[model samples]
Target: MRSQPWRPQRYATTAVGFLAALLAFILLDAPMVQRLEAPTLDWRFQLRGPIAPGPDVVLILIDEPSLEALGGWPPSRFDLARAVERLAAAEARLIVFDLLFATSSNSDEEGRADAALAAAIAEAGNVTLGYAFTFGPEMLTRLEDSNRPPDGTALQRYRRSPQAISPLPHANGTLLPPRSFSGAAASLGHMSVLLAPDGALRSEATVVAFEGTLYPSLTLQAARQFHRLPRSELTADVGQSISLGDRRLAVDSRMRLPVNFYGPAGSFPSYSLFALLNGAVPEAALRDKAVIVGSTAAAAVPVFVTPYDPALPSVAYTATVLDNLLLGRSLVRPEWLRGLDILAAGLGAALAYGAARRLHPLAVPLALLVPGTLWTALAYLAFVQWHYWLALAVPLSLMALAAGFGALMRSQAEQRRREAVARERQNLSRYFSPAVAERLAAKSEPYSLTGTQSATVVFIDIVGFTGICEALPSERTIELLRGFHSRVERAVFGHGGTLDKYLGDGALAVFGVPDPLPGEAACALAAAAELQTSIAAWSDELVAEGLPRLKTAIGIHHGPVIVGDIGGESRFEFTVLGDSVNVASRLEGLTRQLQVSIIASETTIQRAREQAGTAGGNIPLGFHRHGDVTLRGRETPLSVWVWRPAEESRVATRRAAV
Candidate 1:
């Protein structure tokens, strides 16, 4: 088998596919791609449904009833103090507040209320108070005025290394509680949540920087208090992970942790502050459990969008973080994961291109779909089973784009090939019969129409052509030849014969040269008989028009011949070369001497008879045996058969009567 020739189009198509994928890779960090990709993570969370949170964490919500019982939205500090006192009395392991008390009260009554709350928090000794860091240009002044740094001892206690917290989110101003409250709290952690570009809170900064000091998040502080881990056991390895005792949790370069929610807002065990205050909750329920206290009143606490809940309360969101920390499981997307994402994009593009090349163009999308579906399933499994955050949208996007571009290029290449074939067919039709030209042009691979083959050759010419031209003008003579050639072309092509070339007033046609047919001899005979009758009719019309009458003679022979395109580099002619061609020409010359319209060699007659018998049909015309005769350029006398059209006899009789 011959090796197929190289095609540049295939390489071009593959390059186009890769280029499309490269473009997608470059835009991996674009806001549009990020926005589109965010929902996929949400989908994974929803599909995984809800799981039971660790029993170590619980929520204390200051809900609508609590607000009503306390008389307003922002419950008095006296009421807050009472709630803290109640939790402490129940021996709650830790009380973390997701609230802020940044300013002193203006009235004496409110001032007394503030002092009472601060006293209660100091008494609890295990309470962690939440504060926020203020950002933006407008807050710079407020940040400077209120920049009383927290106790250095407390700050250094959580700081493993300054370099570890350098990359964390920076804040210019602090939203700290009043001095009374800040000094009374056992620990202070920032209550700053990180939102995605689309304003959905899916993660939080585990550590934040302010005034050259690092502060832990409220969730982290709560976890530390619950676990009772030593300060040395809590370590921050920025851009990699955070070690809490023996457990390591992944974090991104910005010291942010992708929060993995156990479920929606109410997944963890929650108790109403109103119930805790009224003694409706059992003391055992609160004992030794880490409690997060915040208001759930719509007007008091801010609502955040989470993966599982569109409007999740801030307290529940904090509880989710603490739950994840206690369980030592959170969605992992470290800085190194970006390298894997890039690899995935490239590999997906290559797969799509290879599939498109092997499959049909119409099925390109389906081919892309298979790998895309598989990858999605695997990514979801990774998320649920391993808590791994694999890039989804970028890889799938690259595959789709690559397949689309590749298919478009392939379609264009096919169109160009078809156009070239159409032009080649038109050119071939000029030399060969329509049927032969079509067969040659239809081949997809390069091929040769040249070979040595058995065939029936036919030759036809106008008699007395030179004399007839002398009596007519040049224009009229040229028109006469065109008419004659047209008639001959019709007869030859109609019978599947290749009209090789025209010889001024004559033409040579052959059957079964390019492709062999079982009835090639019979077909040749049929063509000759038809030509003889048509030429006779044309001569009668010429006579009626007062033009000189015309006559034509035909000869056919069947034999093996060499057929191919033969000539110099500049030009070529597809024609047959063999003794059979010469024999057929000589037989045509004998038509004038024998005074017959058509003549055939004995071999041709025998072949024709055989073909007709095989086809179960009668021969197109009858042949009368003509005795052996010597022909020009032949040493042996060739036996032949001759035929005269009945149309010629009828024309002669009609002319006599006229």
Candidate 2:
């Protein structure tokens, strides 16, 4: 038999799974989750290890040895001018300083030193000087008029688009070199770095907004000069990318590029300023290469943490940015990637929910892990192979939430089903034997109790119930009926028959109802014989107690009948309903005229013989053939058999004589 139709619980469970995923997606931008996600990106970089750097850029550090060679902390401008002249003479493609020359000397001797440095910068014609921007509270007090750079300075030659709104980092005031020094420089750009939330340097702003104009970074200016592109080739598209001739460098919404470091500090070729100035390092080493000069001396410049090194010198950080710009290998985390992350999270959650619903309990964990592991592997491969950053934490959280919630919903639904089964068993006990009811209720899978099947139907009644009731008072009549019902229940249930229901003075029982059993006809025949013996014993007790004796008539028939819970919605009964039932009732009435305690149709007797087979010796041999008689509702006459035990016959004869 088939189970009932689909229910709402399944739909409710699916909806809950999707809802959990949506909640996770909403919290993707929370500060705590984002903080947890940051370390994952760091782990990817560490796992990829290090790569070889290109031979296009080099670092010249003013190390401790160079500082000692120069006599003290502040090197003389004359020495700095000599270093510039040497790099220019070597025909270096670009010379960028990760330093600020914002002040001039007070002594006559040092004044000439500053003038000599300016003349050296002009003669070189390819030096890009570094500057700084003040963003502190002091910037608020400075007048805008005094903050402007000198006219015709290198910073003004760069391109600035009027239509593009300024989305780059804003600068409050400038820290430029003296006018004599700046006027002679070929280019000027800011040397500013912003730290990550964790105090690690990972990205740099390619351009900064200042006084209604855009200023390029030190690395950007060096890239422009190294390529020999005119000022118009360097263009900033705020919140998108930087257009450098035919190539576009991707940037975040804030116009920042994620610095892809080749390795730790000294990843690029390096030399000491002392060696370069003293002619110990060959001049040809600087030929056709862009050079960055910064101080590696203790406390000389700020040191920041990077993915590869905990204390990376600021000069090396600038070199990393320039390397990315020249090679077009910067890490990209564009705004559109966030949309893809959300889609992956949503789909993964839904798939996890479906898997948890159908898979076994032990396999559920594996099901949840599969999607999470696959996404993580894909994200790592993308980062290693293509420098693409994919989100890790948010999508995993979504899958876990959906799977857990789906499991909880399934557990609750199971609990509900168990409760329903318990109630059904309690109801079934009213119309069936305890064993039958328990068997029906304990099924692991769903089943239906309504169907058409062949069974043996038995009807039993008190032969003179009406006359006996009149002779007794109301209370006595109830007691008499209870005694008779108790005996009938024992006889039917003892032989595995269903006690369908009780009539006012009679009861109907059936074999093979709800589910069919083997040898059901024999079981029914045995129940009929047991009822005859039980009622006779009860009648003798009543006679000894000076009350009316009890007598019962039973009829048994074997045929097909429809059995199930049938009636109006308000009240229903599990019973057998067919012509077979009517035939059994009519046969029970015939017992009175036949003067026998039991009268069974020939069909029932033949079925019993067939089912008993070689075990027929166990069956009682007291039945006698009776003449054919037409039942009340049927045109055909049915042959029947009657049985009258000797004890019952003697009891009846004595009553007739009296």
Candidate 3:
């Protein structure tokens, strides 16, 4: 058959849809989302500069020295005044106190302490104080006429704690500013946790939205001081830039970015108040730096404990804002990238399906490895170059799935194709030899061959066929033909021969071509014998059906011949076109001439001789050489042989002279 390897197969629409759907699915269920939510690994990818050089950022611990020097819990009121004096003298730009002054008193001693602190605050106007409010919005469940602080709190304001399913006055939401101590300093910032979806305080804050009003973040307020920017100057420019004071602050407006969490966990500095009050680093060390005074005391801090420092106490979350402000660093993930994540997942799923469908088995590993590695490197590059936390999970996951699907689909398709081709080859064997039929089928087109080679061919015919058909009905003739063909086919196949063609009442079978059998003549003889035995067995069944008994004669020969497909596109047959084939046919007819069964040539006789020698003299067969005789077409005659088993059976075979 002629090779036409470049032709494209008809493409299936269902296949495309399947490929696309599979890819989309892979993108959506990316496996890295769990890791993305982890605080530690996330910090590693997003962390960057402005980390205060380790030594510059100082944590002044309010230790036992401060406590013992000025009693605890509402520390000696006089102590607050003195501390403010010293901190103001130290030249701290923003001295923030993470404590509230909520008590009311007119006693001379308390008044004197308050006056002294108030005086210090008036002088050091850079002081900022910490304040806090209840968790959420405030409202009244039902309207009330008076604004007299209500009987307690509006039920809506209370947020209905679970235990409050029973009767109790709702708690009022407190506005902690004047009463909570922010007014004591020039500026006030909330000490609230900007809880993330993963509940890690890596990113600081955006706008603190509540009750339809947006308040400045702690970082923003401190930044306002650092840059000396007013609320009006806090302009967000085109999402790409922001302006605060003279400084165009390096920040994102939609602030869900990565923060440079410097170390694995507890990298935040801590110091003892005893050393600070005693001027441990000398007063020169405190000058020109922003001083944020908060608690390192166990009961005072809220939630800063980390694995690295388990014994560490919680501090006001506001200290984090202060830390971020003093250093000019920020982690930035643009608003646009989240949408990209969704798209990435979907696209990945489709590619996976295509890769699954398209690649061959051996090529599959390269198909997966190249793209998987490329996507990962692109993700890392995005982090370094753009500060964009483009998600790696969905795309990487999709690539993996595509590779897997490609491998699985390739495996399955190959198996199915092999089975299908095998079945087709077998079904054609009823008419053609398996070797010839396989070559024809694999051509991707019907038979078209040229040239030829040496081959062994066999022919079998039903005996007394004309008389049997004449005696039988048309359907009976068909049944007889079907039964006869079945026996011949089974015999030919059992001995590894091809039934090349079937002419009514007979067939041409071959043992060698497109491939040769190890012992073409011997195998051919076995098939012929099996055919004869089968025909004898069928004779009784035919007689029982009120039909004549059936008999068959087979001819086998091994010799040189020109073998190829013959005839036009409309019809063709793989045939041996030479004198060897003619002699084989003549010899089959000569079964009657010789009054015997199988036949052979000198070549097969010589081959059998060598095979017998190779088998340690065990193969039992012999041939008597006959001198050359002229065949119908040949000027030169060819020698032949007659064969029989060493222990002669009734069957005898004569080789035709060519």
Candidate 4:
């Protein structure tokens, strides 16, 4: 088999895979960089006041129309007075404004409006206005020091939001801060923002860091407002709980919270400014419902960009934050998840390597895909159910590792195939003859013949076989047989012969069994002559050892014979079967009767004569004809020959030596 250039190596494969994983890891940010993308959480005094110490909450927005109808910028302070009057009329347990009035009024009309507002404030002792603190600590501290609680009033349970103290920036966009303001209203809380990981509103954020201090986000604030729950009543571990005198309200324990954005979207609660001011909503609805006021005006504002407000109207943002708390559908990524991310990545990589190590190359894809699916599911659960952001880097890296390792192994396999082929080619020539080796190398597999068919056969038997065996001991006979067989085998091989078997004093050989060589008759005769000469030359050694000399008679014939492996279940021999083989054996028996050491068919005699004449210097060979003969089990006659050395050739060749 030929080797391919693209082979996979186990070690190199591992290396390439790890390298790919590392590259991907670096590109995907092995260490995350955090960015904040929350929108503005600012609201007017009307929405911020009366938000705390109360039932679970939902923030209804009172937007731009209210501004237009009541007159803009410090809308008839008297109108805000009317808003309070309305709250008092509704018998609301708490009234928190979403508005702020920072500067003092001086004009007679404004003064009158202010007096009216103050009068309403005095009347509605339950009202609390929203106030914001600017960036600097000293400025906030000064304001905190100077702000006195009303005569018998208590300080707010929550402090100003540090995040609002200063604006935060992220790579994608800015988390806008409101125009910082501080007001005389009590029960004020910093309306802060929540951020998404990529700075997009695809998911919600609950917890945020502000000015070195973490704060409850917009949804939490809205939740606190809805239930009139003070910060003290809300437990981070058990969600929110509020007890307003006798009644109690509850919210989930796990979040700042996120809204489930049900699509068939655009269902956000939006209130036209005019409708809200004219008491368009039933007083019963307004009485206790938390009103979180913010602009839904189409124009983007410096404070309109809340984290959850991306592409949503600001009113929707308010609703989203509020509803998120009520439904416990907050998208709160776990804060202490650095450990999980690292663990996930490490486990994923290890699993990939393990799979690569243990499984076949084909299994690597399944290894990667299976784990990838698991990770995705885990990520979804963490995001939606558990509100945690799980790192996706790990499992993805594992996938890359498996694939990369597989590719490397594939390349290495090809390399090994090439090497194996080279080794095989190198060793093949040693086992087979040059001709056989060449044939084996030409195609798909080794050239071999386990079964056989028609072939010419030959068998040689010594003249005094039984007598020699009687005179010699078994060991000597064995040694003599070994030596004689060795010699015969050499001659047979020289003529491209296959030795089939050997018994007491003779062996069978075939010229055309394994491969049918042309001139089989000629080659067999030459081999026979060589065998005779070889034995005759060994006479000196026989004399020295005081052993009888050996002489063999060769028989040759051409006829169809089944030449192949022939044996029992356990042992087989590549030999011929049929009348032709039997005839050859019978012919061998007649060599002694014919009184010549070599006998061959007329076919062998003729072909030998022609070959000797054509290819000179073949051997010291000569032949004589033995007339037409019939052998045992033969249906037709065969004209045969008894061939010997040239000097004695006439003895056998002359008619009727018998």
Candidate 5:
């Protein structure tokens, strides 16, 4: 078989597809695609279901009931002090406030209440206070006035060049706890949350560098204080892990950590502040747990947009991150892993192109479906099984585009080829069945002249055709010819034989002409048998209609023959011409002398017998050897065989019995 010619446009489409994938990968961080990623990440949580929250984490929520029972908002600092005292007495491992107390309440007794809250924190000795960072002008001015020199006291020191400072989230100002309140807490951490482009808060700065000093996030500070890690033991490098004693925090270059929420709001066990304050909750419930105290009252604290919930209490984000760090289940997508995404996209595009090119035009979509589905499953598994954010949309888009584009190109090319072949098939259909016409049209070689191949040639003619036609009017004679042609044509095509042409009272049929048949000789014999049966039936019908009976003699021979257009190009006919064809015609004439409806050359008989031996019962007719005789064009004797229908033998047996 000849190879197809190369077309650059086909590959150009594939190239464009691959480039499209690359473009998607590049735009992965764009606002639109990133928004797409958020839900995909959320899908992993949905797929994994809710994982059990860490055993050592709990929330002491200042919820609606707590405020209703306590009879106030912000619950005076003195009231918070009482709650802290209760938790401290309960032997809580660590206490973290997800609240801001940067100023005193504008009341006369506010000073005393602030002093009481400071005393409670100093007495607890394990409390971590939270503060917020703001970029407002007044906050910036406050930070400028209170700007402390770079402190060399922190443990998580970052490696930076003399002039190259560590890149961190910059905040002009912070809403600090009151002086007394800040000094009493064991440590203070910033409660800053970073919202994604879609305004969903899915991550937070692990640590923020401000005013020449680094401040750990509220979650990080809580984890550190709980683990009792010294400042000297904590260390971090830009774009690397922050090690604090036994816990390691994976952060991006900007010191951001993706919040892996365990579930929707209320995933953690919560004890109402009013219950704890009133001794309704037991110390056993608080023992050994890191307690996070925050307001769940909608107006007091803003809700966070998390994967699990859109209006989750802001404190849940802090608690989830703390839980993630404590359990070492952090979700991190290292900078280097994006390369894998690119590689996957490139490989997917290459495979998709090859599959489209190799597969049948109709099967290209099916071929592309396998890879597309497998890649998506793998991406989900990467997130679920391993806490890695494998970029999916970008690479998957590339593969789909490339595969689809390649398939489209291949389809277009095949469509053009089919259109050309369809035109040729129409011409061939005039002389052959549609099946044979398609085969001839599909061949690379032309049907006009210049072909010699092994084939089975058959000649079928009406017995006593001249006398029968002369007795009928010209119109009736033409009708008889039409009926004869239909019967012969049906038999030939029904048995995979090609009807080559009509010859007035006879017709030329060929087996294995346009294309080779597995058993051309057997097929020819079968077609002859079918033609005999059909002629008998038609004769019965004609006799009943008061018309002349019809019979046909068929001759078949298997040998080499010249097959192509025989007439001049101006008016050519696709037909066979050779000694083999002449022999078949002679055998048809001999059918009348032998008193049989069908006769075949010894060559055809041998071929049919061989085919029958390979595939049982390929030849259904009973063949009897006929005496050899010299043909008109040849001096040598040509052996022949006669087909005696089994029905005739059966009828003779019945007559004898009668």
Candidate 6:
């Protein structure tokens, strides 16, 4: 046996799979893969269902009903003023508006309404008004502000060194609340929403850098007020924690916080502005809760996209963020996650490689599914139970791809092995069984005898072949022999019997060679019957073609035989050399004396009957016992049975009785 040379292609498949996983990990933030993360987040929400919002937060919606009652879109400042007054009277802990009052109101009733709203804010003392940061030609063309801080005292008290970090987005221009409203309000926060590349709101910028100053987001400002934290104690460190008294948040380098939405829109308790102004809302619902007032009417306010809802109100988003902070629960993509992703990909690659290399080809598909299913389950568990979002789409896909690649590579290797065996079988077919050639190809050992084994040996010969060859032309005789050989070969291979060798007008077949299989005797008998039927059909075809009709005789014997590769190393042949093979050949010669197409020794008949139960069904051999006779080279006489079809046997039995 010779060893095969090392092939690089063998390891290349696994390497490719692993490298693909690494590539995907490195490009985790790419736009193509980022889109996949959305569905995984959605899966978490769907699996967990809806959770109740934190008890300390409430959403005050200026909904369609409010607009209808106020006579149209954009409720008058008076309506807003009365709503604010109601909240103030209820003694709410903090009130933050998602609505931006960047422009002044009209004269007459509007001016009075604005003044009234401003007075309500002054009275509340905990109210924080929203100021947007817009970027457009209108703002660029206009004269810039004096760069005055809205909350100068608080800004100066909590300001960090300007050179420490610069992660917040620099605004082109600021949208401040009307001076009167700003002066009346206790604090002001920016209401600039950040949208993901896919147009979904997944994170919130807690702070924005503007004109050498940092501004807290609306949610952050409202939360700070609720905690009653002084401006001097608050701190913002980029890529670190944002400390407001005892409530500290671990934010990303961009100072953005991931929002774990409780549910879809309207998950929180909400009361319409009309209901509040009409005294329909209970005072207790507003008391001590972090209330967010904003328009849910799409026509009036910007309709933002969220994981659970596409048309979520901006105010609801702010409320959810506040809820996340107050509850100290938010999805964090830690810095170490990249390393973890790489580890997962590496593990998947290893599993895929192992499966492809060790498992059977038929089992490859099922083996590949294990990693995909396991990772998905782990990802979901991490998100729901641990609050860690592990992106699995890319990692799992890469794993499956690797597994498939490995399977393909293995299949190609197997195919090549088969082709090599097929070429060997073509040559070996001259002196060995196809089954023996296949077994030899599979093993890395020299072919040899495995001692004595019970086998069913068959011999087939064309009757009167010598006379037919002498009478016909050489070409016609060769064609007839070729046709006879083809018919015998099909019968042998079809029944799982091995075509041992061709002997001019005769051929030898053996069963239970290379590997022992159940029903070997029965299979050999079946092949003999097939040979007779096929040759009979071929003889009829020859007669129709104006050629001589021919007949064949087959003999089957089952007993111990010494089977192995015989002859020298330069030219060796595989064959069985024992009394059983000799008996089978002699039985074929006796077929002429008995005038029967098939003759099976008593050994073959008895073995076929004994193994019939394990062979899955009844044996098809129908034979009647023929008297025993001493065969040449045999010390003892052997009993034989003349093979006959079921119908022929019935007719013979009837004739005998008559």
Clashes of each: 0, 0, 13, 50, 1, 0
CA lDDT for candidate 6: 0.78
Q: What tens digits encode model 6's per-residue C-alpha lDDT throughout 528-608?
A: 887887887788898898878898888889999897788886877777888889899999988998888899998888998
Q: State the displacement of the C-alpha of residue 169, model 1, in Å, after optimal TM-score superposition.
A: 5.1
Q: Indicate the residue-level lDDT of 546 in model 1.
A: 88
Q: What are the per-model C-alpha RMSD values against the true structure?
A: 5.1, 6.3, 8.4, 14.2, 11.4, 9.9
Best model per lDDT: 1
lDDT of 2: 0.79
lDDT of 3 by residue, 1-658 (tens): 2334312211322343355445544543243454453443353344432233233334555655567665775566566666667767777666666665445446888777777777777678876654443443465322233212212111111122223222212222333433323444555544444444454555554333333223444445555665555556554432233445555434333333244444332345554555555556455666665555656555555554221222333343444445544454444454456556545544554455555557767777665566556655655567555545556655566567666766776678789999988887876766555565666568666544546655677877776799878877899899889988888888887767777788799888877666766666666766776677677768887788777987666665677767666887587666666666777776666556554555555565565555553322222244455556455555766566544434344333322321
What is model 1's C-alpha RMSD?
A: 5.1
In model 5, what lDDT does residue 173 have?
71
In angstroms, the error of model 3 at 314 is 6.0
Q: Residue pairs in steric clash, candidate 2?
A: none
Q: Which of 2 and 6 is ahead in lDDT?
A: 2
Ranking by TM-score: 1, 2, 3, 6, 5, 4
Give the better candidate number (4 or 5) by TM-score.
5
| TM-score, predicted candidate 1 vs. hidden true structure | 0.82
Name the weakest run of 10 consecutive residues (lDDT summed) in model 4. 37-46
Number of backbone clashes in candidate 1: 0
Give the per-residue lDDT digits (tens) of candidate 1, residues 1-658. Answer: 2324435544654565556557655876677888888999999988898888888877888889888887877888888898899999999999999887777899999999999999999999888888888766555545453465467313344434556666677787777788788788877778887788889998878877776766778777678778886556666776577777788888876788888887777887888888888888888988999988888898888888887788898988888888888887788886667666776666667677667765787788875887688778888988888888887888888878777766776677678878888899987776567878998888665444455689999999999999999989999999899999889988988887888889999999998868886688888888888887888889899999889989898889999988876777667667888989999999999999999878899898888777775542235645567779899977899999888666655665588799
lDDT minimum window of 10 residues, candidate 5: 145-154
